[model samples]
Target: MPALDLPFSLLDRSRTRAGEPDAVAVRATVERAHRAEGLGYSRFWVAEHHAVPGIASGSPAVLAAAVAARTHRIRVGSGGVMLPNHVPLVVAEQFAVLESLYPGRIDLGLGRSLGFSAPVREALRTARTDPEKFLRDVAEVRAYLQGRGPVTARPAVAQAPPMFVLASGAGLTLAARAGLPVVVGGPVLRGPAPLAPYRAAFDDGPAAPAHPYVIVSANVMVAATRGAAEELLLPDAWAMAASRATGAYPPLEEAAAVRRRSLTPKQRESVEQFYDQAIYGSPDEVVAELADLVRRTGADEVMLTTSTYDRDELARADAAIARLFTA
Candidate 1:
């Protein structure tokens, strides 16, 4: 057995179920995380998003704190906190306080996007937006975290956690040069082209840990049968496909509801194609597919995330992946 180093984590978008008459979604989210922790998964991360009806992880720091307090061993932190949406000093103060409470277990993954639409982005952005603000902010954040400055973090602030970059495009190049871990992936469908560039850009200099680390979160959903898995995942795949086509955020609620209704022949064809290229399959089949992805990207650690809302399916999927690592 290779030992499961997949270090599965939840990249929660924070949307509740559309029509379920139960309150299990939120509790299930908590329990699902706890189960991953209990299963010896490595890290548990929540993303920072804003103004998306389907996403509740608008506050990664607060959510991270709750998840951290609930679980004991698993590393809990933001898969990212959208940096441009915040002032770096405020970001520093929030995370420093988190680190103080959960020493040696906090991680701060930063992304430059506002993580929302224009209006939402504008609302979240403070009155300051300099062109080189990220660089200046990052430096300030680094200083505040390292206790190297007189304007130290306040309000129960503590040591800063490891910083990472959630990168896409030239963002990878920047992360490497700046000396931070780069998350080469997330919810969107992926292939070798993007991951290769991200790996090549890394430098492993003083800004990063002794060894370079790359974390990629791939979309996956496992069910008892391939048909069932594909059936359940159409909404997520279709939503992404729509986002790709229009460069607009798809209505997730509408997308989810689409699954329960009959689809047009064209839409069905598109969803089927999407499943073929992205994620949709039985557990064993998914393992074979993802192992190939690992070979292509040279990912040091991969976190298989389920964008679908099926807790049992995700659990079964994890067990299947865990078995491979054991094998």
Candidate 2:
């Protein structure tokens, strides 16, 4: 509830670990999400990334249950579940069970990307299709939840919680048309351009709220020293930037190591530029920036993800951001 006052949600992973060596980090991250519920965070979302050992959120629905079991009040859902790989009925059934157990604390954020490499894509054995197919799955998901889809799956639609499309491109428009709420996924790293696209195309449909429902996810990291905060966050920013540029999932390389790697001139430039959009600074500095983000984007919420892996740091970050209003 406090995060709602500040309107910050927690984006976490259930299965994916950042640094290698395997099993330990994966479990630790899930435990971290469960513990984060005690903090003043809103929804807790796990993303769907496959074949990347570094990615722990591959089965978001399953992870949602694990997180929900451990925590009491905070909402739990997928930051995104890539919709291209599976059948609609299956998702409907799986989440149906989840919604039944957890009730109101469920969110389903869907994405259209494959979320894996070509080889991993083949291993999933899913057929690649047109973008429109993504919409069909959405419709099917909506129909099931609204209790209108076919009865063959015997899906408990009416009992299912809520679902939203997690999109980077025109996903807001599709969500707007469907009258479902949407959270603008990805770092506001691209800044207002990505945010603008989602807002410009939002439609006022039957289920539409009078105001737009936009929660821009922020890659914010704050600490005592601006340099310290940036240092803590650089690894993630560097990793994310690398993945975007190469479409190759790499381990969470140290920022310096990543910088020294075989980066083209343009790639180096991109990595530097991406940080400009993220909130990485001291508590005082971050408050000024974070407040401006909400005011500028008209985003109803901001999901903070970066170095939340450290509890003391996270508590300080929360306190600092909260001070803006209290002061």
RMSD of each predicted structure: 3.8, 3.6
Misplaced by over 4 Å in model 1 are 1-6, 20-27, 126-132, 155-159, 186-191, 194-203, 239-257, 260-277
lDDT of each: 0.66, 0.67
Q: Give the per-residue lDDT digits (tens) of candidate 2, residues 1-327.
A: 122245667776532324556555456556666666656567788777777755555788887888888888888888777778778877777788888888888888777777457787888776574567787787787667667778544546455566766655666667766556677645544456456656556665644445457777777776777888777666666666667766754556555665567867776666676677678787667777777777676777777665433445555665554444321
Q: For each candidate, what TM-score against the reference?
A: 0.82, 0.84
Once superposed on the true structure, which residue ranges of model 2 sit more than 4 Å away at CA?
1-6, 14-19, 127-129, 152-159, 185-211, 244-246, 254-267, 307-327
Error of 1 at 75 (Å): 0.6
| Top candidate when judged by TM-score against the true structure | 2
Model 2, global lDDT = 0.67
Q: Considering only N, C-alpha and C atoms within 3 Å, which residue pairs clash in candidate 1?
A: 1-326, 14-56, 15-54
